[model samples]
Target: MVGAWIWNRNKERVETCSAKAVVLATGGAAKVYQYTTNPDVSSGDGIAMAWRAGCRVANLEFNQFHPTALYHPQARNFLLTEALRGEGAHLKRPDGTRFMPDFDERGELAPRDIVARAIDHEMKRLGVDCMFLDISHKPEAFVRQHFPMIYEKLLGLGIDLTKDPVPVVPAAHYTCGGVMVDDNGRTDVDGLYAIGEVSYTGLHGANRMASNSLLECLVYGWSAAEDITRRLPLAQKVATLPAWDESQVEIPDELVEIPDELVVIQHNWHELRLLMWDYVGLCAPPAGWSAPCGALPCSNRSWMSITPASASRIICWNCAIWCRWRSLSYAARCCVRRAAVCIIPSTIRSRCLTAARRYSRPWLT
Candidate 1:
């Protein structure tokens, strides 16, 4: 909100897509984990922005954790896609022991929830930093062909997929829960829509079935398109939105604390990340899981005025607060965060999609 105007935003507006529509292509709640494949800018900002504007949000929990993200101390963020397992892969213990069997009968072939929870359980029991995924038993050609991206990145990081096991662990990766929407991407409110990872369509069930993430996007985006095109003909033209406000506020005019120190920002950011990973992870809500573990944000500006001399100090403080909040925002859905899974079987899929479809579209519009 503090930067919404600077970011070319404040309130949302209706839009004309190829015809008339919008899709909140915001990805998943993965960054809530310490290790993830999502770009750093992701923070469930789209979801919150939508909700604050009056869209009904849903199933804010039920995040999906990936079972095999690369876990070397130097390579924790790179995801080893399930496609690797689809081709041929094994989850091995730190000591070169194959342990997936003890967790699930299907082993690497089990659905993501089962596999990720298994990895989490193993990591805890073995007291190891992370487990490993081995594709080394496969021929070099096969390994290279199916996972060229993984192969190249690992090779650069000094781990060869054809010879050594890749360090792997479960990282929060997807939100099986999200603002509820329909197959048509309609939420409770009219003229709104949602799609992609942020919307929970029933197809994923309690745990996501493999390869359905992208498929859901395509399927429902099409549905949203049809619904929107049909509505455009009947939609009315509205008046222009108001210009931004500045008559009451002035730019800062000083520079006492603008050295641009990012250390505090980064440290708090990482701390918020690990908090989420440790608190809410795989196997769905394990006993006493809260919404997400994260830090509250505060800046010196909260204690000072936005003036020229104070601006620099405020900016630095603002940056630090933002760094903290953005990471925490990843796991925060709509409210202050209910801190519970809180989904009923009969309502799980429908309510989430309903919330997403009827309301989430306005964020990007």
Candidate 2:
């Protein structure tokens, strides 16, 4: 890898950074989904950037939705830790009945994927907005002692963690697949190493076990560091690189313009998020996979046509999100096709596809 073209948000200009090696430790693309526990910066920029630099990503279809995130109008992206369940919290309905045991013998102790699927199934089955995680039966002192931070946070939100059942829902938590990398965290592009949630090292398959992500980061980070150290002596430095040129760039007039373009950009961003949440979320059908494949091109075209030459940070973020969305759509399509040909029986495939069509949303049709 030579360098990267970076946007300087404060300076309001593009700049070039020369580097012999680039490491992408950016977190997952969970922010692509409407309901996610990830921060705003987790927009899949690293994975998109790696893809743009000729790296092959894999298993983008395997997103991990966490089973229980705090579900409240004001509590955006707040996650209720799995430790709550581990400490005997029960997954309950609004009517105060346990539901996890019906789905799995392990109940709340089931794996994250199964638990998330169960919660999603129950929500759709009952037409409910959210489920309840009840640990109210536990001693108040024990709850306070074990989870002081969560207790305090929930208390501040006007929900007592010790006395009341917490409203919860499944949320996009992790991107199990990303830019494909080797054991040493090297991507297809030379000198470009991707580690952490941004790299797909094939450790986490269809579902990632809780806390395994941290271990992957630790191991791969060390391996990459060692590999880079070994290769640094042999690497030849580039003496000169092209500087960023702003000639002929059209700057929008702040005095005359009303900043109406922002509305369009924001609309497109909203549409993109809605599209992913509706079509590419957990429990998506084959039709869901196909819908985004058809719709994303139109969205991309609309975004590109209106985007100015000198784009804002939000516009650049939208571009990264677009890349991530396109990659996800492509991966979803591939998963559907592969499942049809290789995984499912021919008779079962036909039945599944028929069911998918029958249950597909009206807008998707």
Candidate 3:
């Protein structure tokens, strides 16, 4: 059941070690946000690939926002871990006044959902781009002892954690929703498996508690491995598959200078991030989902017209939007069903799921 697939960066071919049981451990889809603590590669590739392969995804709406990402133009989503807050770091306004206590009695130690929402609220209310995390009151020896990594990294970035108030903002951190998998890490697609942040295993309900993701990933990885081992003895072997089709794929007449097209792609990515950051991040209401959902098809059509090399990037962005919409609708539906009196009704979720499925059909098939 062990397998691997590596797509040639310069060519459109994917080299597979074996395809008997595909284990997709590609991590979360947090890069869809403008500001995310996720690694740059966390674009929901596993989730999108699963959906394309016809597996259902669930609970996409519950993206966990980390309350403190260092807000520096050069830092680029460097995370200031929750342990800083856990150790009595103060979340403060730009004017050096503390704010978290006003939002929650637990102050800096409140759950991520509440802290993220509070920071987001404060940022909006104060018309500020970023808030501050102050742990400067701690002894420098203690700071360096506890957070050697963050301290050194911040120091390298010219911000001393021992002296400076770290400029921070809430950023998309973890995806609580993903391709639905059973306890054995099995998806709807037979012989296909998902684990890590890519699979929704009912461990993280609405919000993911701290440090549980790594634990869940380790547990599920072992489970999937065990399940595959048991089935390996009876596994069906297949002949070598056909090569990739380039018939419908049009190679450009030349590597045409399409900086404008590339610029458009950049603009599209920027716009997508803006829509999510403004509407979907931290606090999502029904009204916020409208603009992005409405724009998806048009943006997708534009992206589809690009050259094949660029089309790959386009497809990634398109799939990100599609999955986000599905997650939002799914969560909205569950919320409405439970309460039965919310602005986002269950029907909205049903329609969103149906439409997203229909929309993705052509892309993967």
Candidate 4:
């Protein structure tokens, strides 16, 4: 069950931003993609709200993508936990070559960001769809014990985990930056507090260190509660409070439609994924992504930059990425032939090609 506090009272109007102290236990930002390792609902809404509330947000450029997520037509977004890799698993290449040993000494057990980028580099360099993670070398009993869920899932896929390699790829999974907060989870504004995935507390640093997100959450929560409990006794320390003055406020009749531009929304989601994948994935400098993501200027261009020419190719790319995610399979021989046969456009080119060429940077993750 989801943990939350429900306030039953219905307000006359929706709040633009929250003012009361709040502990947003909302988790990671994984839904900002076509594929993710997190539940579909983890789209950083708390951070968005806190951002609207004029809080200082830091490290937004840091996103952690999981190294090995399952890929299938029906179940491409499911996660294969790090625990599986920790025990003993080999990340493999298309020809069944064990490749992770070359990237790092830790092999399959390296930190997620590093492993993810390693796999990404391999895919991009080889022009392949996806890579594989082999755990089938273990005994069937060991597989069932260490990863019962994975074993059963693979069984349903008509694959035996004790015999074959499991396909996997990196997917956008976590956000490291959030609204700034103090020792008590308090924002710069008084009477305001942010918690959980919505606050940046410097615990994760540039890249998360595995399973520590839960620890950080618990520690920050305890500190915030302790501070509040200590201050509750002197509640009336500020007796003279401001008045509720609604002098020039009026309800507007026009319902301003949200940015319901479907193409734009899809475009931005893809861009955010690609951007984080390129810029924030692993071993990046703290000041690296800061320049492009510095201010309104970059975000502005981002909103304009996505077009049919710019991101439409991603549908094919992401589909290809997901197709071989968990199966160590490839369709390079025939898939392209079938896909390219039915294409017809006035011109397959647009100004988007120029924009991509101009703004392309290695720093984009």
The model with the greater TM-score, 1 or 3, is: 3
Q: lDDT of each prediction vs. the true structure?
A: 0.60, 0.72, 0.69, 0.55
**What are the per-model numbers of colliding residue pairs?**
25, 0, 0, 10
lDDT for residue 86 in candidate 4, whole number 0-100: 83
Best by TM-score: 2
TM-score of each: 0.70, 0.80, 0.78, 0.63
The predicted structure with the larger lDDT, 2 or 4, is: 2
lDDT of 4 by residue, 61-99 (tens): 455668788876666567888887887888889899987
- Per-residue accuracy of model 3 over 1-365 as CA lDDT, tens digit each: 33544556556544556567889988887777778988756777778667766898777666677788989888788789889999989999999999877766799999776677778777877799999999999999999999999998999989999999999988988878888999889999888999999889989876678889999988889999999899877887855655544355553544334445444555655666666676556554444455345543223333333333244443333333333433333333322232222234434433222332333322112
- Per-residue lDDT of model 1, residues 1-365, tens digit only: 11122222132221222313346667666665577767655566556545644666665555656778777676456678888888778888878888767755787898775677667767877788888888888999988887888788899999999999888887766667665787798765566577887666666754566678888888898889888888877776533434444344464445335455355556756765665565544433323244342242222343223321223234544432453254245345332254344444455333222332333322112
Which segments of candidate 3 are over 4 A away from where they belong?
Answer: 1-5, 10-13, 16-18, 250-259, 296-299, 302-365
For each of the candidates, the C-alpha root-mean-square deviation to the true structure, in angstroms, is 9.3, 5.5, 8.6, 13.8
Which candidate number has the best lDDT?
Answer: 2
Candidate 2: how many backbone clashes?
Answer: 0
Candidate 3, residue 327: lDDT: 31
Model 1: CA > 4 A from native: 1-23, 72-76, 83-88, 105-111, 145-149, 246-265, 283-287, 290-330, 333-365
| lDDT string, candidate 2, 231-265, tens digits | 98888875455776645444444412435544554
Q: By lDDT, is 1 or 3 better?
A: 3
TM-score of model 4 (CA atoms): 0.63
